[model samples]
Target: MIDKERLPQVAYQVMNEVHEEEVDLLNRLENELSDEVLDISKVDELLNTLLEHTKEHFANEERLMQEVFFPAMMMHQGEHIRVINEMKMVVNRWELTRDPELIREYFLGTLIEWLMLHINTMDTITAQFITMHKGGH
Candidate 1:
């Protein structure tokens, strides 16, 4: 099994690359938003897809931590839960208000920015724990 610490870096790498795809999706929704042309169905699909991807990524990382007996697994997972909850909150807001600009700002800017930092810092530390558990393999 891969070490937990090393796994988060790999996760981070994959995420950084995939983020552009998320951005592209967001961009596709942008015009719809700005013009008040957003199809609620489309917005729902986009958010659902993004949420799914986020869940998958977190689960994969958590599995790696579990495999290696990473001590911080629960803490790491709690963070993931927080992210999920926040996304859910955003989804609820979007559903209630149907504010395209808010969705855009949340996903494209604040959300992405938060993720970049989370992956680089907290995730890197998680990776470090994995690496150490594996004797820096």
Candidate 2:
């Protein structure tokens, strides 16, 4: 459960909105996983939804970075790639094992931690750079 208040805000509106969406998706997934009668299909669906959202979000950010000629584009894009790949691997594991505990621990712990740190660091820097480059838009 991500406390919205605790989330670090980025300079860009679009990025902030996407981060909110990401949090929402993860929260929903966590609720679904916490249910005792785990619906494997529902969890799978949410996971897929999150993955798709992440892809679109990252693509949008990458495009902005390119347009702005962001100096740290390579590092930021590399992080996105790494996160996406890890998500894919998790999805694959879920399909093979249907392990609720595995999903729960990963989502509630690892994923949330990673998201907070990423937003606080890489995303904050990227958004600031983009906003500054765009004359504070």
Candidate 3:
């Protein structure tokens, strides 16, 4: 597992623990790293962490859809599949480069942006749908 440490809250998850894994890494990077230990290993870990994050988020969203009998479920599932494929392609390229910095940069810049957009758009909808359909306590 990439980023053995739990992460900090980068996404807009209603749950706090959900953000812990990434938060831990943010803290670690801030404390450690002397331009030497920062190698492709970190990149590999972050990539794996990203893949895991994607999987978890996708699974949760799909589960919600299945429970709700969501109409746009197919479209959302398609998007999740596309995201996995796109990230894998990027990971494949980064793998060829053998540069941790490139991976870090990609994750920080592009991945974060893509993730935020997805969360704001798709994730938000899922959460709202679930909450609304649940008959509000």
Best by lDDT: 2
Worst 10 residues of 1 by lDDT: 1-10
Expressed as tens digits, the lDDT of each residue in 19-88 for candidate 3 is 4454454334333333656655765675677678767867766886798887788988998898788778
In model 1, how many backbone clashes occur? 3
Of 1 and 3, the candidate ranking higher by TM-score: 1
Tens-digit lDDT string for candidate 1 (32-134): 5656455889778878888887788788778768978887788889989998999999999999998777787887677767766777776777666666665
Residue 110, candidate 1: alpha-carbon lDDT: 78
Number of the top candidate by TM-score? 2
For 1-137, candidate 2 gives per-residue lDDT tens digits of: 88787889989878888899999999999899878798878988999999999999999999999999999999999989998998888788988998887887777778889999999999999999899888545
Which residue pairs of candidate 1 clash?
A: 4-130, 5-127, 5-130
Per-model TM-score on C-alpha atoms:
0.72, 0.95, 0.69
Clashes of 3: 8
What TM-score does model 2 achieve against the real structure?
0.95
